[model samples]
Target: MLPSVTFLAKFSPAHRRTITASAIHLTPWQPSSPQAEHASLSMMADKCKSMDQLKQIHAQMIVTSRIHDTFAASRLLNFCALSASGDLNYALKLLEHTPMPNLFMWNTVIIAQASSSSPFEGLLLYADMRRRGVVPGKHTFPFVLKACSNMKSVRCCEQVHAHVFKFGLDSDLHVVSGLVRGYSVSGGIGDARRVFDELGNRNLSIWTTMICGCAQNDSAEEAIRLFDGMIADGFEPNEVILCSVLSACAQSACLVLGEQIHEYIEEKGMELDVILGTALVNMLLRTDHWLKQNSAFMD
Candidate 1:
């Protein structure tokens, strides 16, 4: 499960200062009691809001006997690889010594590599996984597809899409979303739209993805049309969707539409925080001259 915003808010200025001081004073290797070990692992998992904390936990784990604990070790490896600075080398070293890693273990490492600076390393690991005869699961394709998206390797994405169908993950939301995103990023909007259309029930995230794809492809008209469709379908627009719509309006210099959106935002009592406010200001500035000229002509 994803961490709640409120839970993440706990890592505020005071907490970060305290954690940093504690990390500096902490002894890397110390003999730990069972209760202490359990507490340490729990804290490591919970307070992993920064790379500093992650490193501190990793160092503590190495110093203590809990380093060999499979569950703790796997979680540590995952946090390190995925969230903690994308340190693939360190993650690989830790995983190499883990005894009889399960599919989750492989999936975690592969995902880390896929999202890492060296994405080709992920492809290499996938090849190695096939050679080791570990059959890939549904969970495996999303990360690989993500890598293909990042690489913009259309051929590679197509191959993965085919494999997803073979593995019966064609109906899986996550796998299908990844395929759509991959094709979209690889300049295959038609393919992406086809994949999106096939989904039995379109979720908000899927709609947002399609909107973003259209926007990125310079199809602002299509993006605006889709946004209208989303509203008609009764999906309340979130900040992300609003931002995309604002961007499309700004690009098209549609001052009337932009003002209408601003009014909608105001009516909904949406917070005009920094980002949204900035976009609004930019759009108004860009179109203000036209508004002024029209008013003068009318006068």
Candidate 2:
């Protein structure tokens, strides 16, 4: 009988590791009906509410020799690596035990680890993937770059940026967006801008990324410039960004920048309504107040 969920939770890390290892290494066999069996087992794995339930399904797979199927192994791996109740250490163990892990499995583990408290683990997995000759698809770099973004590891980011070009994934919107964010976090606004400029098909997301990247790096002037360009490029400015750039402008306390926001709202006739009229009213009051302060200082 499997340990109760509460009992399993109470086990020491070492004991848990022992149990996970024993559960995964169940006597191996090649199932005669991997397709049907793995599919059904995968459904059971997906619906598992706790590790105990997952272990039961996993043991069933082993007994039926369905664990040899990559799809079946990956389902268990995905649940363990990603589910809220799942265990990452157990998932890593599963990755090793799988006879042949596929790109999806590798990516699933990488994605989970990249977003974990230890992002370097994700980077390590990426390096291991390269060592094993598992060619990364375009979807892979964004997650890899996400780790770099989390770590603020500019050098790692730059290395991954090189890999982006090497793999010809530089044009992937998500990849470049991640690159822009990674660069921005490390105060490499120029690198972010260069990446932003390199991409030809700039969606609102990419535009927002570059603009927010600028705004965050204290490059308010650049943010305002890009915001202008975003508007010129036929993209409507959303209120979140509108206020972000507006705050930067208000902080710079430059009347010209304040006027630019007003001009943008008035000129664009944007109907993506967001209580912007109140924002514009506040902008005018602040602009008036800013002018008063400067005028008094001149006196």
Candidate 3:
């Protein structure tokens, strides 16, 4: 009988590896009907709550000559690369083995790597994809752009921005938003503002991106200005935007503005999320201290 998942979890890391290797070696299989084959493989993929189970299932795929099946491979890749429980190295190895991976496979890997701790891998994958002459789709650019944002790679970001324009994805909201965020995170606040201004009708996310970007890059005054403009334009502040403006208020020690924002939060019935709550508390404390010192000097 196959060892249960609970049993595998109890094993030491070294013991788990040995068990995985043994399971792969002992498992024998013949090609079943196509539908049945995919069903079985997919079932295994979905039930992969641990890395060991994934390895054994992958070994089964190799033995059954189903490794080349893009659907099956993609499912396995999704578990290993994208899911929090899986390993990026294993996913990369799987992709390397596939002979001339199609667009779906390439995009899947890029998307997974972009959101991983090592976002630079996604940027590298984009370059590799271009070298391989793989045509990028709309879905492709956002993932790459997000990687740019995470890496704060303004140079790569500008190059990707040009690519977005070249591919006529300049009008895509997701692509534009990614570019705005990328530029902002890279300390290119002017470039981010340029992107924002170019948009004919700005959404709340676009406003929030610019505001938060300013706040993050130590341009708290600019963040406040953007927040005021966001309100003037009639956009209701969400928790994210509120936290950002509140942060700016705290940094600049703008007590009146902070109090106004606190009132806005109460009037709007917005929840005080941890970030917002912290920002508000800090602002109140700082403002109180400033007032007390000024009064003491007068006395």
Candidate 4:
């Protein structure tokens, strides 16, 4: 129901003039007061209800010579790019107008788009950044890799994987985890495994991604094997890891293993929230069904 960027742009000329006319109102402000300036912008950004409001504020900032204020711009862009009050299109428009967007701006937009319904836009933004000769930071790869994961685009993921190595982020925990997830979703489990094997001090997220990826991609037995290795390697399983292992148990009809997991949950006092509860309950139901079918056959 919010206005689109194109729709909002139609009124920019009028809004710009209105802001320019009121430029004298902001003359009392001093650039020496960075904290006060940030506070004022933050409060205004927090109160913004629509793209028009944001554009109006942006216009005012321009007239007040605060156009290049990174903090103010970040707050505004974060609202536009990530919050419900704004649109991705508007966020993109804002970025397009920025004379030189910093890495934080790029990362924010990339993350917002990747997490949006149309995730492919994040990849396009990444391409745009590359064409502009912007060097991607450590935070940049994970979000774009997430876009690759969401689209299940193996070719795109492969290109990003190469970029990871090129940028010397191959060993970065979050980047490697993203690569593992991207490969897993793209049905390149072998590549995912290769990346997993190369990790020296594997974290819970990396292990969870590989296990969940295997469970979802028809490698349930491998998931179980990895779960065992995770425990043996001293990584305590979280609810997410347990849920994935439970799913693998359900797929394999391994009642013994499922029961062990249930006992482990009790031992660890892990909360059985909706997701983990559903996984455990489904595992139990599937195991019982398999047992009944087997017993029926024997009878």
TM-score winner? 4
Q: Work out candidate 4's RMSD over C-alphas.
A: 6.2
Instruction: Put down candidate 2 lDDT per residue, 1-299, tens digits, no spaces.
Output: 32244655566544554555456443433335647556767887887777877887776656456788888888888899999999998889888877678999999999899999999999999999899899998888888888888888889889999999998889988888889988888778898899988899999888888888887888878888898898899987787678667756765665577777666765766543445544445555666666633432343
- Report residue 287 deviation for candidate 1 (angstroms): 3.7
A best-first ranking of the candidates according to their TM-score comes to 4, 3, 2, 1
Which tens-of-lDDT digit does each residue in 36-97 have in candidate 1?
Answer: 76566756655577655666666445444456677777776777677745466666776776
* Clashes within 3 Å, all models in order: 0, 0, 0, 0
Question: Which parts of model 4 have CA positions greater than 4 angstroms off?
Answer: 1-39, 46-49, 289-299
RMSD to native for every prediction?
9.9, 8.5, 7.7, 6.2
Candidate 2 off by > 4 Å: 1-34, 254-299
Please give, for residues 1-299, the per-residue lDDT of candidate 4 as tens digits. 32244543455554644543354243333435756655776677767777767766776566544657766777778888988878777777778878888888899999998888888999999999999999998899999999998898989999999999999999899999999999999999989999999989888899999999999898989999999999999998888888999999998987789888887987787776778877887887876656533432343
My TM-score estimates for the predictions, one after another, are 0.71, 0.77, 0.80, 0.82
List per-prediction Cα lDDT, in the order shown: 0.73, 0.77, 0.79, 0.81
**Model 1 residue pairs with clashes:** none
Model 2, position 262: C-alpha lDDT score: 67
| Model 2 CA lDDT for position 113 | 93
Residue-pair clash count for candidate 1: 0
Which candidate number maximizes lDDT? 4
For residue 187, model 2's alpha carbon misses the true position, in angstroms, by 1.8
Q: Return model 2's CA RMSD, one decimal.
A: 8.5
What is residue 259's positional error in candidate 4, in angstroms?
A: 0.9
Q: Candidate 3's residue-wise lDDT over 182-233, tens digit each?
A: 9989888889888888887778878888899999988899999888898899
Regions more than 4 Å wrong, model 3? 1-32, 289-299
